[model samples]
Target: MKRFYIYLLAFLLPVCCLAQETVIIKRKLTNAVKERVSVLKSDNVTKQGLYQALWDSKTVLANGSYTKNVKTGIWNFYDTKNNVIQRFNYTTNTLLYEAPEDSATNCRYVVDHTVRDTDRTTKPIVIGGRFFGYINYLRLFRLPPDMRNINNEVVVPTIELLVSPGGRLAEYIVHFQAENYDRKVGFNIDYLSDEDKTFIPATINGEPIACRIFIRCFLTSGGDLDLF
Candidate 1:
């Protein structure tokens, strides 16, 4: 019996070691954004482990585990400051945590600018949270050549997002106002990327309702879009 037990232990040790071996892969998404994934290769070569998307190779933007290349369990999406903006349980298809409306922080970037005098129980949230919206805006927004030379002045641009009751972006409006210059640009919902069209609509009494969300941004001296 002792000899049989010794043989079984030896057989299991190699299997444990093989299962623990994880391969880490890094992918560059942009000049400052990248992704790192820790995966265990199966016979099918599908991603089967931890995944993280990062900015500046340090701040984690999103992280979760994958099962057979599908997101599982709870995933955390973060802001540039490394705050957990949203926590979602993919397996259960439920929101676990969403950062409360804080006018000092997240709200400075994305705000519910609807002109409703009534109060709402919850504000509309972008699919991945405020940071996701901010990043996408930075990626897609282009500065007009005429506004490039403005210096020592702060310019605020309002991006209006009309979210439908079904959590879809219905319309987009951009109000660019600078010194003696005011231009409003309208865009169809079809112009947005598929990912950007997703949102968690606002609610008043546990019932979803269409609302308008505004992404407010300012331009820096270097002509870069930044949060207010």
Candidate 2:
């Protein structure tokens, strides 16, 4: 039996209901290419198979039912493994449940969560017109003076990248105390005089939405940086 439980997401609606069961899913996913659906079968004269075939052909980002084009009912979102990573209620436009990030979260998996900002249709490409990927972005990292002093070692930290809907760099947070750099290496993104946070907007529905980009940054001792 496929059991389905509906619980209001506490973060989205704290007062909806107090008696709630929670399922924490922490996993990683990579966006897979859209699959091509087979030809419509209505012309083939099978009426019974029409609806089911259409449902199978649908490839909507937010899968749900629509009444006169207005979204309604529950929608289940899937990951690369076809697992339900997230489920939302379109009637309220509220999140019902989402999987939490696990130790296995990596670039190899399909990203069903915004913890890495993959929901956006576009990811940031390399400065020189290279494709959008973590490894490509890391190669462009050239650290400022305060990043490190060690010659060959590297410091990895959780970086919070914020950008405007118009694709301008808004602010960045570097966890100075992260990894092994307690006080030896640090720089304030807030203090930068030059505008450095330029990025590719994560767009959807033909419009840009502000999003948070979180990634592990490797600040090398030779003024080089790598991101994983």
Predicted model with the maximum TM-score: 1
Q: Model 2, 34-65: lDDT tens per residue?
A: 22222223332211110110112343222344
The digit string of per-residue lDDT tens for model 1 on 1-228 reads 999999999999999886745677887644566778776644435677888888878888898998867778998998888988899887997888998766665242233444356654677777566765445655555666775675526556777777787888887776777788777766555656776787777776677778877777666565655553
Pairs that collide in candidate 1 are none
List residue ranges in candidate 1 displaced over 4 A: 1-32, 37-48, 67-69, 106-120, 143-153, 187-195, 219-228
lDDT of 1 at 195: 63
TM-scores, all candidates, are 0.67, 0.30
Minimum summed lDDT over a 10-residue window in model 2 is located at: 46-55
lDDT of each: 0.71, 0.41
Candidate 2, residue 195: Cα displacement in angstroms equals 8.2
Report the number of the highest-lDDT candidate.
1
